[model samples]
Target: MSVSSVDDRQRAARLLLRHPLIRSTDEERYRLVRRYSSDLEEWFEINTGWAMHADSEVVRLEREPATVADPTHPFATRRGGAVLSRRRYVLLMLGLSVLERSDSQVALGRLAEQVIAAGTAPEFAAAGFSFDLSTREERSDLVAAVQLLLEWGVLVRVAGDEQDFVHKTGDALYDVSRRVLSQLLVTRRGPSTISAQTLDDRMVAMRDRGAAPTTELRNLRLRHTLTRRLIDDPVLYFADLDDEESAYLRSQRAALCRRITEFTGLVAEIRREGIAMVDLDDDLSDVRMPEKGTEGHVTLLVAEFLARSGVAEHFVASLVAHVRSIAPDFAKYWRASALEADAAADLVATSLGRLSALRLITRTGDIVRVLPALARFALAEPTILGGRKP
Candidate 1:
């Protein structure tokens, strides 16, 4: 048979297979056979070696199930299967490095230098950055990577010509949301649990207390203050702090300001910007006023006065006379007269404890230092300002 005839027969066979009934009246059977004659002929030619009966062949084809492609199979169209390439990983690391070093602008040459210093191979750094190249292909990859980071809102490139492109001020620095590089640097890790003796043994030979040590107590005190300052400043950069204590300092972040004026302004600014204050007293009217004769109330009142005055040590007689004059009701309530020596001593001890608990004053061997928070509070409160609480 001709190739075209064979193709027509195959098409007829498909149509015949789609039909239901096989047996019928002689006339009906004749019509059906005539209609599917090309189909039967095609089936016969294709299955010639099988020598199967027409009914059996029809049953076999009908019983067979259709083959289907699996839905779960890995296809090129599926998402989340693409792995990050090595070059992309390196670029990400470089971007992080740039963020760690600078907040404002970072030049391509400088970034390349940092990457090289960070132990990336020289060739990779050289290929990644160009000081002179202005062509699209040469610069496209780096620019694209930076643009991707900018789109992610983790970086921003300053507006300029291609050759003059630099990271924007405060753009190179990012709040690294994840601890991706914690293990990469030793300083990024937490404080070691090693004992002082072990640390000394590892660093230098054992020395007597009389021996001149590398770290003196005064130096340690200075280091502690400096480290504390870094932790307390939100805008402080890691580069601004000493590397040896950076991790420790980074861990101990308190409320950003130590001074009352700074704290109040910051709080007021936050409130003005519609930021809700956390852990604040909601009802100003509900503030408990100190009562007379109550040891706790009298102690708090005395401490508040001394803290307000910014005086550490007051003469016992002077403090008693002052308290008696200011809080005459409290003096009248006192079972022991304000002039009594025992009453004066009791007042002082109670006041000291109350003030220390409030962190208003620090007592070291009878000397007290006023905390800045308390000093600010004194300035704000009417009672401390020599006026009655409204």
Candidate 2:
């Protein structure tokens, strides 16, 4: 490829990585994606097993997580960025099911009624799920789901506002984009074909059943799985890989990392313990460290403390105390509540949450273990002129 071609391809891949679904409404990005559709499609498929589809209207990358059990990244509201709760997730799925059977346009009240019916089904009730939409809270949950759909281009407001419906003062209407709805699921097998009784079994069955029973196929699956983690995750730790995966990655690490760097423009930060596809632009990740604001300040401070303290593990209470001890110096720049002794726990929890999500640390109950990646945040001692220590 020409240098310009390489740059364009990298830009297109970064765009898709940041926003998996791009409609023509995003004019420039959509056009760029379409320009290199064939190359990008082949790259994603070969590297990550992710399917890419594009038409005149939209470009969609069907992505599946390397690890389904990861709970660090949740779907948050586009408006306030509140993480979707279990109730909201259930309502979201229920609303989508209703929309799947509805007309191109749907009304807020009608959607809520259908969702209520779906929630009250015997199977749902047996599963301990219930939502009648009789209360404003329930209605708000439905609105949250609708807002997410709207954000995703699955729904476009045509007539009314969602807040009015939440207040019971009026209703809203939306134009459902069936194309976007159909593109949302990224499973390897048709969900209907998976007859596994439990959700976990069903998930495993859906992913594994379609694979071929051959050595080449197995190796290909391993390569795709590892590449997906390298691209999507903050860090791909060697400790997390199985015996086969570890052996394969050990032999193929350089070629695998080179392919990723060439395609995505990410520099591979190779450590003794793992590999991190570091985005120089720092925009590819959903979570960021050394960020701004009071929360960010506390997180950076806690990270430095963890890295410099030389202790691998610390109790949650100890971290809370550390936060409280430092609050006096930073109190003026932080929120009023950040200085409260009791608020230290919340601060500690928030800081640890960000760190853990970034793979810098791990928390098990009250214990937090600082991982190897966090050492990057450690500060070296400053020296004065003529080699004099500060």
Best by lDDT: 2
Candidate 1 runs further than 4 Å off:
1-293, 312-321, 324-329, 332-341, 379-390
What TM-score should be assigned to candidate 2?
0.95
**TM values, all candidates:** 0.25, 0.95
Q: Distance (Å) between predicted and true CA of 303, model 2?
A: 1.1
After TM-score superposition, the amount by which residue 272's alpha carbon in candidate 1 deviates from its true location, in angstroms, is: 20
Mark the 10 consecutive residues where model 2 has the least summed lDDT. 72-81
Cα shift from native, residue 346, model 2 (Å): 1.1
List per-candidate RMSD values in Å. 37.0, 2.1
- lDDT tens readout by residue for model 2, 19-58: 8999888899999999999999999898888899998778
